[model samples]
Target: MALLETLAVVFAVALVAAVAVYIKTKLFPLGDGEEIREDVAEYISMMVSVFYALVLGLCLVSVWDNRATADDRVQAEASALHQTYLLADALPAEQRGPVREAARSYAGHVVDVEWPLMAEREPLGDDGWTLLDRLRTAGELRGPGTTAQQIAAQEVLAQIGYVDDARRGREAAAEERLSVVLWAGLVIGGVLTVAFMFLFGLNRSSTHVILVMGLSGFIAFTVLLIHQLDTPFGDPLGVGPDPFTRYFRL
Candidate 1:
């Protein structure tokens, strides 16, 4: 099943369970009013809440780290592209325009074509790298440069290498999948926490308790929504690299 579908099923089951238990408890109050009075139940519920909070925090951090890493990689790649463009000045006059044109074309392809697809978690096609190879090869050093200049050129090219590798890593990071066990833990924990709330008569009045439940449910739903969108390259809330689009000058 799709991730969304699986999530839907989890929530459906949890909601049914919560409502069913709530109704049953209301309709037929335990004679002794002691369904969860035991110390063991209290301890277990507290431990579950703590574990859920930790897991939620960890998942949020992991997703945020992935996004931050991707953003940094893109920035580095752009910087390298810019440096490579500037390096065209070092090439012999006959090679300058072609190198510049190739760099521009590569950047344009990345911005116009690759960025959107990446935002949607799509793999970049082989063509981008093909263009990169052509561009890199376009500027051949015919004769030895002054040692310093040669070193500088090599440094710039090294930066280009970094950009290429980093971009690939960013793309791979976007495709990273959230662990299914974590999702299971979130769903189960949420249900148990909410159910525990119902078990205890926290709200003196039914209306207040129902209000709390609805509000809590909404919060849980929002967290789950973020989890769904954390892939940003995924369907719901993926971040696009359109920020670099204007450089295309196309």
Candidate 2:
């Protein structure tokens, strides 16, 4: 959703909540002790606060899980590519150099070229896929030599397949984000929860201000935290190319 639209929705929610509470207070003044339905208000406020907290927790968990999955994809891709590099040693002498170079080129492309693209949520193009295909071709060119060589070649192909799968997953994760509905829930829930605090009549104005300040600040912090973590390969809580660097020593 657009920023202005989101802000408008939040404002409307808070305004409605404030108007409702004001009417309730006016109809059943706590000071007059006219059978005040404070119990109902209290129940409602507690429920809003709890559900706001629950929504915050759910968003946090969702982002954290997405980040973890992205990290796993990176690790799996790097590990499989590393294994492919190692398996190059088992190929026949003529095939060894080509296979090793292909593996190195692919790893370098990932670390130097593709990592930045993923971080920026940009398309990586077919360069990566082409590189992977080259690695497969290099392994295939072994031309059915010895038994051990054949087995190693098979293993190399398997590792390349693993790398391909992980790369696809990584790409998918880069474009992933928190749902707009969840974002709306977060904002509306937070506003309502804070707004409900106004329903209660505190003896001390300072106490009310302090309580509102703390609650609003906490809600803002959590929402911002979730926003930062929403992108699988973006800032503060993003998955990095450290796995590739670690595996390939890039």
Name the candidate that leads on lDDT: 2
Mark the regions of model 1 whose C-alpha exceeds 4 Å error after superposition.
1-38, 143-152, 214-218, 233-239, 246-250
Clashing pairs for predicted structure model 1, backbone only? 232-238
C-alpha RMSD (angstroms) for model 1: 6.2
- Tell me the tens digit of each residue's lDDT in model 2 across 159-201: 9999999999988888888877788889888878988888887
After superposition on all C-alphas, the RMSD of every candidate to the true structure, in Å, is 6.2, 3.9
Query: With candidate 2 superimposed using the best TM-score fit, by how many Å does residue 79's alpha carbon deviate from the native?
Result: 0.6
Best of the candidates, TM-score: 2
Candidate 1 TM-score, C-alpha based:
0.74
Query: TM-score for all predictions?
Result: 0.74, 0.84
Model 2 ranges off by over 4 Å: 1-34
lDDT of 1 by residue, 160-250 (tens): 6876887787677778766675676677767777777655554358776776679578758757775765775555556555444544455
lDDT of each: 0.72, 0.86
